[model samples]
Target: MSLSLCVITKNEEKNLSRCIESAKNIVDEIIIVDTGSTDRTVEIAESYGARIFYYPWNDNFSDAKNFAFCQAKGSWILTMDADEALSSVDKYKILPLLDNEDIDIYLFHTLSYMGSSPGVDTASNLNIRLMRNHKGYQYKGAIHEQICNVNQQLIDKRKVKIEDIIVYHYGYLDKAVAEKNKAGRNMKILERLLREDPEDNFHLFNMGNEYLRLREFEKALEYYRRAYRKFMPGLAHSPKLLLKLVMTLEALQMYEEELEVLERGLSCYPKFVDLEYLRACLFHKQKKYTLAIKGFKRCLTMEASPLHLRNINEVEGYRSYYALGEIHSELGDHEEAYDYYLQAIKAKPNFYMPLYRIAENLLKRGRNMDETKAALEKFFGKNLNAGAYGKLGDIFFSIGRYDSAYEYFLSAYEQMEPNPNIYYNLGMCQLYLKHYQEAYQWFEKIEGGRCCEDAVYRMALCEILSNHIENAERFIQLTPDHAYNKRSLVYKAFKNLAVGNPCGMLSDDKEESNAYVPIIFTLLNDLLKISAPEIFEKSLQLLNLIENDEVLLKLAKLYYCHGYYRLAYQEFVRSIQLFNKIDREGLRLMENIMDLSTGFTI
Candidate 1:
């Protein structure tokens, strides 16, 4: 019984060699069905002794595939794509399967890879890739086509068996180029189909998929939602359809809607790991840490191979460890968090995310500053990207190394287009170094937004510090309610002292009397080492009494202002370490204070 391998292609020059090479010794004849090729694809196929045939480019993929299958002359036919190849073990297994006359249709597992990762070990589904030529099998569908008649024929006339052989798919190699071609090809067919049958849900679904391939998510979602609305009620709740809906919701950033879709999908297909993993992500995004942890753990227990979900064993192990690390970090279990992060690195040493996260945890603990610094430096040395430089600057800023922080921040700012936050940070660094004129210039570059208010207020203070009294007073008058409002008032008082009207300044704003006094004392004492230590100790005591995080944080900054670096670092670390245990408002307040004081010094 001679075996024939048939493949359909159009400009598959790059991948055709691998496919043909894999089948060279296994088949008696090879047939290449070319829809059209303007390249050396046909020449390459001919070099492998493949009999070439040409067919007009039809809108239906199944029609093309079926046409190729019909022209094969061997007793046994194997259908494969130009981007697919048979592994040695699969080839060995296939030869024996082809010899078995009892088996009419044989299923082979397909593995698809994305990115630079290794092919996933798990096969999600089996396809009838090998069949008897005389079985009268044919393919169906126009876009995401499938072979249907063979299954019926096998059941009616002969026995069927599933082979352990696997087909490796490299279609996602150079995904951008392949996706561009696929989108163009599919859109042409789908547009024609939709023009003829506008209301067909399947046509709408195919069109949506084409749009999704183009990353035109909003338009894709419109068609998907339309398809779902038209078909969902009558259709038995399918995990596939539900998964698609959940993904659409995720892309739209409708977290609540995504959760609803996931819950519904989970109820219908409880064992589906894809749905579970997505649910976990939704929970993580919502900051529902406990639920997210539960879902991730459940996904780990599923029967599906990690590879089926586009994860290798290494990636799966690392993901589990990373998730545990994040959960523990949030729970204030720093020791456990650190261990899990190490485990994640062990699982996948080249992974940058775990290393960065682990360093962040170490910085919070304050016990591994040198180690964290080394890790960050190593990361930056290996990846000289803008993000790495920014993170390094952040580490320096956090530890009060203003000069080093400024250098790294400036490096990051210069290497990339300046973001408002980066400019604000540079401005803050200038202010800390007492470069009043330079600091004012940097702050003026900031536009008003959630992150720009503090910088704008600080710019006003720099005007006062540089003795621009009129500009200082104008800025102070224009200032609205902000975290730096109290600081602005103190700067105004300092401006008065710099001139000769301290008495007049002291008499105004009596309603802000309680807030301004300690701040003024802290600033004055910061200028005097002897009094600064005493004021620092008093502020620490006040911090203990304050129930509000904002108040505590303000007191902590006062301590820092008086050159109490150790105490300031301790307070900021405590706030960050307890981030998960606090209420939302409290967390936001602490985050803001940490952002202001830490600037990224390790």
Candidate 2:
């Protein structure tokens, strides 16, 4: 039983060598069908001793692949792509699987990496990649091609799953997708295919997949729903469709609908632990702690679903353990939360979330920098790297340890090249430590990176705090107009105060006031810590513009709680006079103020 590796290529010079080298020992012949390459793809194939066949560029992927298959001359065929490689451990298993006579075709688990980096997150699916040649097996579909027979029927029942033989596909990595314009190309092909057959379930599902990849969630949901209406259980993509539908609904904030679809999916494939993990996450989002805990614990007890059914890795181990830790943390069970976080670290030593949590929890419990660092070292052993240190710095910054966080962040930057996150964190640490000029310098390094807008906002604050009013106004103008940032009551108030345009605060309406009244007080208190007394007075004036008794009272309560008696006295008096009411807390505050002033209670 000889295996012929057949691949169709177009400008795949970067990846073809790896693909061929991985399979060189196992395959008898390499067949390369070029679809009009303008690069060294054919040259690379020639160097590998591959028998090259030239095929003209066609819009249909199935046509190109079928042409490649027709040129193969071996008894068994293995389909491969230039961006994929046979797993080193699993490559040898393929030849042994080809010897099985009863199975005409074999399915291999394809691990497709997501994001710009590999091994961080992946999605797995089974594909019919190896099959007996001369059995009339052919490729179908225009874009996301499928395998069919001479009569155009799927070869489903004759296929056997070989778990030991795996394929690692790198074409879906974010950088690769962007460089090759795969989403745009796939969208164009899928659209043309859908136009030809509007009711084709496979086309609709693939169209949904393209939209989902592009993050056009609403459009994705529409196509997914349409495809799901005609979904067949026997189709290989059925599970993927269900999972994507649930994810899209969740993205659209249609939680109720998401749960409904999740239940239906679970009913169909109860062993899909990833879906159960998602259900637990949804429960946690909705604050249904009991159900969330139960679901997560169930994930811990259950094994992984079959490779064909697995959408994500570690659903039953580190991911679930980390999630349980978060749930316990939210429930205020610190000890239990700490225990779960430890277990999560044990399960996946390099998982950053639980490590950050453990560090933050230790600091919150009054552990000093030395103790916190010792604990983290114990948990991570010798596996900690620059990325881990950066995360640890973020946790320290979160708990108000600016000096320690700054040290760790600087160390991380020294160990690794300075990225936008470290720049932002280092700038924030300096900002908090009141080294305004140093903070500005760090923020300046974030030129066009992911944290540019946030850095610009901090740059404005740095200028304002340093009394460079003109520079502050310029930076404020440069701040990105994100709705969540621009429309923030605190942000608006700060920008106005920085520009000396106190009337800019007047544009905030009752709706903004009503929505922000609960938390705005604490935000204002933080603002007061960084601003002058004049700015604090201006904030009071803005509060008066809202005409909210609750807002002023809450502000006064925050001041009193934090022992700012003078500020509390002013707020209490303002609230009492403006709203014409006084609660017991206000009366006590007034009495305390009077006692402080004259040694007598009012």
Candidate 3:
């Protein structure tokens, strides 16, 4: 009934200690087999009181593994590599599973965090690591090795439905794989195996995986096709092979082939969430959004199961929800998209992919600024990130709350450093707040990035607004000479007019006859299309109802977004003026008119 922990290692000083530490308390005996060690690997093993044995170096993994197993004294053997560890929960379940004689082998779900987003872990969910010594099980293959004739050896693998045990492996990470030259080493051995048995689907599959690790996606797809050609009839490893082919096809932008593979796989593995997810993703990529929405909804209906193909991906919850959000956002259903994005964020608080869509949908949802501000506050209270805080700052800045925007910009700076665009935003906040020195400092932080041109131009404006003529001359030299443009002239002229400089207003008239509102109306027009396309496309009908509160409110949002501050201010003022001439009992409506005009959040 005693268990032996068996490990095979070579130059594993960094990982040996952790692997031994996780098992020392549970196993009755610990065995370490080293082919060679030029580090403290053997010493660390000896320190843990493990029985150490040495074998001559041969570039064969299964041979080394089988050699270690033959030396085990306990009735059952638990084997893991030096770079792998059993999680705390899995460690506790080992003794109970080892005590039960009903199962001949224990399979662990190996979680590998190696995808594009490495933080979101996935697994193969079917690794045979624990088995009875008397079962006479031995390893096979020279690389990416596994039990010889696994289906024949572990015929009763489905008898126990235990999914709690897990092995966290770090070796597949980009850094780890590159350092070990693992892909190259695996490629050499797998090619040798294929030469010996040209019809071996398992060897073909192994070769495909090695190329995938090296990012030779086209070659990987070719090998997957060869393997699947032989194995498709039996559907042996259909889940793993189909996932590999589809992912490679995606990398090659072959959405049609990807869909074909997924559909074929789904016919056999009907309830597979990962297949459904990839199908939905391809539909989204193809701009078939309505179909993508259907695919994503189907993903959520799938039950959570330990069944996984080559890649362990769970789509029954947040992943599916996030995809749905993306589809709705693309289709211009901003409100529905926002709701799905909120649910995705709720499902996984640390997952940041959904956060940007939430912020973006909030900005363009056609809601009043008050509602947008309220949602931003709620989101930032729960999750503080650069996007959320920056968008909130943008909303406040648009609505003329410069002081409030300044505070949120500071919060955003903490999360996203070295972002020159946010620096420009902070400078704009300071400039409008009349903190010229502070705004100058923020603008100076930009050197040569995305917003550098705009920052330099704004620096010149800050100088002109402050009446620092000498500083303005210096900024004129430093900037791209944008201050000489008619847009800049109009901005400066109207701004001075607002500050009670009648001479400044006359100066604009003398400089050019064109009106300021007409010059910058395009910026306002663009905002209308982005934020409220329905109202923008049918503006003739809406504009005729100038006396309507809803029309005035929508116009205000567009003007605010476009930096037509003075003109927008005049419209709000006119709304109030017209309201006063109409009714006396509707003071509340008058107050709302004043609020919209005066940039007051209501």
Measured by lDDT, the strongest candidate is 2
lDDT by residue (tens digit), candidate 2, 1-602: 89899998999999999999999999999999998889999999999999999988778889988888888899999999999999999888888787777888887888899998887588888887898888899888887787779954555574655554679999999989988998888888888888888999988988899899999999999999999998786777898898999899888778898999889889889998989999999998777899999999999999888887888888899988989999888777888999999898889876667877887777777888799888876654577778767777877776667888898899899998758888988998888787999999999999777788768777877787787877876776665554454324455566566457755443347676676564456446545544456655665655655645566677777777666777778878877788776776577567767656664322
Q: Where's the lowest-lDDT run of ten residues in candidate 3?
A: 539-548
TM match of model 3 to true structure: 0.64
How would you encode candidate 3's per-residue C-alpha lDDT over 423-518 as one tens digit per residue? Answer: 888887887676777888999999878788667656765665566655755665564544665455543443333244432231223224333344
* lDDT of model number 1: 0.68
Model 2 has an lDDT value of 0.81
Residue 489 of candidate 1: its Cα lDDT? 54
By TM-score, who's the top model here? 2
All candidates' lDDT scores? 0.68, 0.81, 0.71
**For model 2, which pairs clash?**
none
Better of 1 and 2 by lDDT: 2
What digit string (tens of lDDT, one per residue) describes model 1 on residues 27-51? 9999999998888899999998889
Q: Write down the TM-score of every candidate.
A: 0.58, 0.74, 0.64
- Shift of residue 220 alpha carbon in model 2, Å: 2.0
